[model samples]
Target: MSETTNVMNSEVVKRLLCYVSYDTQSKDESSEVPSTQKQFDLAKVLKKELEEIGASDVRLSDHCYVYAKIPSNLDKKVPAIGFIAHMDTSPALSGKDIKPQIIQNYDGGVIKLGESGFSMGPNEFPALAELKGKSLITTDGTTLLGADDKAGVAEIMTMAAFFLAHPEVKHGDICIAFTPDEEVGNGVEYFDVPGFGADFAYTVDGGSVGEIEYENFNAANLRVEVQGYGIHPGSAKGKMKNAIRMAMEFEQMLTVFDNPEYTDGYEGFHHLGGIEGDSDHTTMHYIVRDHDAGKLNQKLAEIDKASEYLNFKYGEGSFKVVRTGSYQNMKEMILPHMHLVEYAKEAMRELGLNAKSVPIRGGTDGARLSFMGLPCPNLCTGGANYHGRFEYACIEQMELCVEILKKIVEKYAVKEI
Candidate 1:
């Protein structure tokens, strides 16, 4: 890439491309905090960048969390605001050897990902139609682009750079953090929210340009295990009870209409994440989600009812269900601190962007942080179709996200809660 191209490309895009190069795909079921060691690879880089950008008290923790503080330039005391993003990518897809392709002045047509390979058409992804004439960064079909949170990271970094160059811009203290293993549901498992030193924060992990999320799913993981009597087919009369068959029956008992594919927009889901088993033993995995806590509990109870019925039919110890709470809807927590959300909205509006306050269908680190006394909401990073090969980020939109962050800081400097 020449200096001309570098100047032409947005700083957010450049930072995204650089961050995605380091493979930071987190591992599932790993006992470690980050679940993967390579998450620190990006953490160290972010620490160095923060220091270079004039962010003070920067520290890269042993668990791959990078924390920094930007001192206040203002005289009056105001609420210290924070910004956060995750370091690891989704473990469901490969985040290795990412080769990002830039599409400048995008035409409203089918976009080919690689030569003679996977393609993205406006017809298939109507969102692309809205991005016409914008610069997009996409990956080759083989790997994920990791825009999910890296876009968030770049936007915050861009804000740090802006704050460094322009000290005259008054603001209260700014706290920033980069977390790891967010994809594995342990984003802030060991996070020190009190030590982060922010009255409130925003996780720049939302999708699209003007999105602000305070409501998210009350999430939980469900597992069903089925036990079966293994008997030879020829000798099996009424003794052979196939566990896999039983597991299938249990899954069937759940309403298919409430699943991920069928539901959208504040509608809860009983997503069958995965299922694996044999004739002797089988297990069914699910992620139960709902914006309403009561509804989420009802979904879990329904799963238990299914398991109870199966056990009654197959005898005791034949079936078992396990439910583990992941994260809760942050709406209640955010309500008291609505000014934080308003600041983001005002910031976007100041930049001539229409801010959309939408409920996140999925959970973010901010959701958990809000419950943990941080009252953090989510801000967009200008990316769409995250966690897959088709994931892409709008370069111009991300630059706008950087501006939004700066505006938010300025808003806090002037406005009172």
Candidate 2:
């Protein structure tokens, strides 16, 4: 199971460790856009790192969003491209004080996360077996590895630094943006596109190296509140409207086939991600997703009808429902601007890396940016099992990822001293 790519620079490991040492976990329940203050800590450091690498006008906004410009060294006018990565990690696990363990020579065996029983192994995650001779950075079972987007951040930083230091390599204007609230779907809420001034962009926030994506689920969030009538059990007869029972009935109205557990790969599903409350009142949170816009609306219609039907059955005002637009599929928006997609794939191929272009089962900042007229797609970071304790990344894969990213930019733009 030894499949290591030793072509990457060893210095990348050093930069990655420093980036992950900061705690940048997002809090979904928070009212703020960033959701966590620690996110800015990392954002500020990245801003400094970019400036230190010769990025001009490196600035951190009031909301902790970081932006910087790398002017083109070439005199010819060309397309300006942007590279983006989110600053916050998922709220799924603790990201504080991450202890990243470096396995210089992976043996394809089980990796102990911590304690006794729970460990990351090939038997559990066969993907680890693919990194036999490669270097691996993993968490110690207690905290999640921030490599999900941080690796993407560091990779972009590494590439940008390379371009700045080697001005002899021609390229166009390169823009870097680090957004917040990505974990909660509000990352690009306040993003200024005209200010960014880039023809096309890519979010370097995907799994596995060489991964490129131009599609994502058309998503919306559903909030259902079941309000049951209260009455003493002893005195209740036909008047007792239990919200819990009604909520169950409402759920039963939808097709179980339209669920996440029953779907995979381009197939969308309705996921009941949150639920709470008892007896007198309750709330249920659902996520409706579909690649097809028509079908996406159909799912929302189904939810509306389901709620209306329950209301009709249990009398008026039996329940309430709200659906918020989360993110959209960028494929349709990207059709007119197809060159960006080809440019990225070609960039990877030119770097001797096979680009795996696919659709995202979930949402990304790129999804939102596309609707905002940016038409952004997602690129890989060479990490895997994101947002969990067992998460790990191939150091060598990220190094190559940085190289491919630079080449992608070089294809469309030039920066020469």
Candidate 3:
């Protein structure tokens, strides 16, 4: 592990620790709007912080979203800009009782993660080379650090403090929002775009330090059900059908290369999720994604074709498939507003960082917001290895993220600043 830098002592890291201390993981099976009731724990904290920082019109929605505004100090008209980040962590790992360790001056050596006997070395993660001599905020090998989006939340909150403390910075209306349930694919389901009243927005939820995304996968959910006939062993010769085996067979129908492990960079994929069942019935879930809507449609059609073939072999009514549409590629919505992308690039340039506009393999709240007339794009949070135990974030990079956001506000909030 590296040495903990003084940057780790900044308000951004302090706010992040405060936010992650609460267990705010969203459940996939929950029918609630925010997916989990505990998410409001952090929502209330953020609402109080926003109000304390002199943010105007602060509101915490019943759905657990925190919205606030930093009124423009300038007299002229400038476009209202918004910054957003999610509050809930992923349910894949435990987020309760998180103990974040600060490692200062990483020495490119094996860093011990608590007493769990688990360690992080550059041998396993070559990207650690780039973080040499930097401070890192990591978990204790038992749970995630919640830096996926919490890092983003901290950065936005820090920027709000800066704007309030230094009114001489001179910027127009700055809108900030913190949402929940983004990890469960329902982050902005009830987000009121017009009510937020931002001409353009940015989701500070990307991985790595310099990632800026305008394109994302067109996503859809797939569900397959198998029905089987159960009979006594003595008379099971041809009367018995195993639903488990049918589900496994359906999985084999898809191309092996069209999965997350075998594809990257503009390539589409069909990812199979949890499968549960016995001999009487089986339920399987999948997610199909692609950069092109036409290709995404073809993937869904392929699932239908697989179902038809299974029905042919196992008799009709034996197999069933259903799909629900999720968010689409935001590239279509962002192309008309290239200035948003360019403005972010210019902000990074001002900070001596080259922002790369990469395509998101998964969906983001900004992608959904773009289609909803917000024209939002994604920015980096300086987090790496998200949604798992190995996740960690760079504190120096996070501070730089805060600076980049402040620059964006300074650039677009006024023509001459």
Candidate 4:
């Protein structure tokens, strides 16, 4: 019933729809900063839109990062807060020519997607049960909805528009940015944290409403290579060692219960992402994740132990393990600034939203930015089932998120904490 809620509803939806229409899916294999050139499409649009909305210092970096500022209206200086979101969608699904389906007044039943034969109900997606009577936006089953962070982008843009429209609202310097390739984990690769000019910031790239995240998994990528002797099948008793089978053995050495499908809520996981090879040579790709840094190291040690045992059993140099650190949990960085979390919770509470601090099962740009310098936390964008065809967003929840953001800005404006 609040003025902000009413005003942001349509505008946020319009922005989201416009953003998803651009094919901004980032590629993981590319060496480019954005990983894909299409991300600039959305970046350009955001830059133009930000300038049009009266935001100052609007600049779209060559690397596809859009940065802008809303000058402080108050005479007294307060902490400059930044709001961030990503411009790229995940490469898991095709993001080209997306035709969004807008379901008005969702009735808590099985809603079918457009002609792609995909239907989701309360039974499958339990989150849908609580979303009845709300307006839902979904994909047509042919492509992803791009709501993972586009919803966040739209919410931030809408909030910026609100602040620019109401000068009397009185706020400190508001920093705004939309970075590229967040889906591929290079969102902050070219980000200039010092130049961003924020005492602290938030990445509005979370699921559902009222979810505030500061903790995320300590992540690493693992590659295991196996070399085996190949012989004719006619005489392959003890003379031949199959690399594919050895690779499977290396996988079995990992704890079965520690896999992604079996783990949840702070539990570490070793996910076997893919396997490629033949009898002579095999390669296994895995991602290791845990909330605790020590536990994450333990997981990597376990992989090393498995590799050593396999090498001992087979032959030296038969098993190889390569571990690469991805990103660490942001809890330590944000702990020194717990007020950021409290302010977000307080803002949501004032808007009748029950904010909950949840651990991010995956990483965000904020996770890296936190360690870089800014104590940034993650905020909800009213999205669900990210990076896939079943992705959707709740219109009412998104409007509430915009309001929550507005409230957070207002709090920072009046108080320094």
Whole-model lDDT per candidate? 0.89, 0.84, 0.90, 0.91
| Highest-scoring model, lDDT | 4
Order candidates by TM-score, high to low: 1, 3, 4, 2
In model 1, state the lDDT of residue 31: 81
Top-down lDDT ranking = 4, 3, 1, 2
What C-alpha lDDT does candidate 4 achieve relative to the native structure? Answer: 0.91
lDDT of 3 by residue, 1-417 (tens): 343446656899999999999999999967788899999999999999999989999999999989999999988998889999999999999999998888888887887888777888789888888899888888899999999899999999999999999999999899999999999988998897878989899999998777799999999997898998876768889789989988899889988899889999999999997899898899998999999999999888888999999999999999998765577899999999888888889888888887889999999999999989999999998999898878899888999999989999998876532
Cα distance off (Å), candidate 4, residue 279: 1.3
lDDT string, candidate 1, 1-417, tens digits = 112375356677778989999999999888898899999899999999998888999998888899999999988899999999999999878999998888877887888887628989789899999999877888887889999899999899989888888898888999999999999889999998887999999999988888899999998897778999988999989789999899889889999898899999999999888889889999888999999999999999999899889899999999988775578899999999899888889889888999889999989899888888899999999998888989998888898999999999988899887
- Which parts of model 2 are misplaced by more than 4 Å? 1-9, 414-417
lDDT of 4 by residue, 9-65 (tens): 599998998999999999975788989888888888999999899999999888999
TM-score of each: 0.97, 0.94, 0.97, 0.96
Model 4, position 84: C-alpha lDDT score: 96
- The better candidate by lDDT, 1 or 2, is 1
Least accurate 10 contiguous residues by lDDT in model 1: 1-10
| Cα lDDT over the full model 3 | 0.90
State the lDDT of candidate 2 residue by residue for 228-322, as single tens digits: 98788997898787878878888888999998899999888998888898867889999999999889999989999988888888777877887
RMSD of each: 1.5, 2.9, 1.6, 2.8
Q: Compare candidates 2 and 4 on lDDT and give the better one.
A: 4
Better of 2 and 3 by TM-score: 3
